[model samples]
Target: MPDFKRGRSFLRGAPAACLILFLAACSGGQPSAPETAAGPTAASTTAAGAPAVPSASGAAPPSSAVPGASSSTRPALSKEAQMETDRLLIRAAKANDPVQVRKLIAAGGDVNAKDDIQDSAFLYAGAEGFNEVLKLTIAAGADVKATNRYGGTALIPASEHGHVETVKILIAAGVPVNHVNNLGWTAMQEAILLNDGGPRQRETVRLLLEAGANPDIRDPQGRTALQNAERLGFTEIAALIRG
Candidate 1:
C-alpha cells in the first residue's frame, strides 16, 4: 500500500530492459541463418558441366543441346528408291562417266549393286579396263573379292583381255592372284590361253607371276600355264613360266 506509483513505473522499465536484453542475446550470441540466393540445382546442369537452360517452349532442351552429340540420323531410302539409285549408279559406272558415277555415289548409291547380268559396277569396270570408273568404285568401297556371273573375279576376264594396267590395279586391290574361275583357269593361264601371247599379254603373265600366281594351276584340259605357253609357241611367256 506504500509507493504504489513507484512500483508501476519500475514494472514498465523492467519490461523495456527485458526486451533489450532479449534482442542483445539473439544478435550477440548466435546469428540467425542468413537468407541465401537460390543457385543452380544438379538437374539444371548438363553432362558437360554447363548450366542447362529451358527452351523457349518451356520444355527441357533436346539431347542435341549437349556438345558432341549427334543431331539426327539420315533417313533411310525406300526399297524402290534404293534399287533405282543403284541401277543409275551401275549404269553410270558402266558408261565410264566419272562425273555421273561420282554424283550417284554421293547420292548414296551402293557401289556393290549388281545389274541383271549379275555384273556389278566394280566387276564391269575392272573387266572392261575402265580404270577411271574402277578407281571411283574402289574409292566408293567396291567389294574387291566379289565375283561375276561366270563365277570368276574381275581379274580373270581382265587378264584374258590383256589389260596389264587393270590387272595391276586389281592385284594391288587384293584380288586373289591364283583364284581359279569356274572355267578352271587361273589369270596367268587365261592370259596365255586366250591372248595372242603379245607384249601386253606377256607383261600380264609376268605381272601375275610376280604377284604369286600358281604356274602349276591346270586348265580344264589339265594343262599348266607353262605347257600352254610352250604349246602355243609363246617363247618369252614360256621362259617367264620357267622362271
Candidate 2:
C-alpha cells in the first residue's frame, strides 16, 4: 500500500477526493477482520483453522450417536445470543469443559452455532484436542461436516493435529472421508503434513482410509500424499499410502 503523499505525487497532485481513494487502495490487502471478539483475524484463518490452542501435533480439527441437526436445518441464532453463546461455547471448548458445554447447550445454546468466523463448539474442541468436549458437542448436535471460514471441515484440523480418537469419532459420525477444503488438502494430507508420520498420525490416516477416504487426491501443486510423505521422510506413512 503506497503512502497517501507518495500516491498523491504519483497522481500529479490529484484532488482531495483522489487522496481518499488512495487511502482505500492502501488498505486493500486482505479481507477485513470480523467485528467480533470470537472471530480471529484473516491472518489467523490462513493457518490451519485458526486454532484456539495448539494441539500435540499442531492446532487441529469431531462426531457421535446423537446426530446433530444439520446447519441448514437448525434454526439460526440471533446475533446477540449467538455472540454470547460463542463466548461460552468457545470458552468451554478451549478449556475442554464438557460440563460447561453441556450446561450451556441445555440452557438453549445451539450446538451447530458459529462464531463470526464460522467456527463452532465442535471445531474448537477438535482443534484443541478436547476429546470429551468434542463428544459433548457431538451428542448435543454438532454437525460433523460444519466448515470453518476456509471451507476445511472439522476433520481437517483434527487430522492435522493427529488426534486419533477425535478423528475416529468424526469418521464414525459420517463426516465425508475425502472432503477437500478450499486449499485442496484432505484430512490425510493434513495429518502427514503436521506430523513426523508417527504411529498416532498413522492411526489417524488409517481411520480415514478405513472410512473410505481417497489416498490418491492431489494438492493444488499436484503433490500426492505419498509424494508429500516421501519428501518429508515419513517412511511409515509413505508405505501406508503406497500400499
Instruction: Give me the candidate number with maximum TM-score.
Output: 1
Cα lDDT of model 1 overall? 0.85
Clashing residue pairs, candidate 2? 60-127, 60-157, 61-157, 61-158
**lDDT for each of the candidates?**
0.85, 0.78
**Candidate number of the best lDDT:** 1
Cα lDDT of model 2 by residue, 1-243, tens digit: 576565545678678676556656778754444466756675456545743553466734222222443354334556686668767877777777888887887666766777777778888887667888888888877888888887988889889988888888888877887989998899999998877788899888878888888888998889988899888999888888777
Instruction: Spell out the clash pairs found in candidate 1.
Output: none
- Candidate 1 lDDT by residue in tens digits, 69-181: 53433224667977998999899988889899888888778889999999888999999999989988888888998998888999999999999899999999999998888
Off by over 4 Å in 1: 1-75
List TM-score per model, in order: 0.70, 0.65
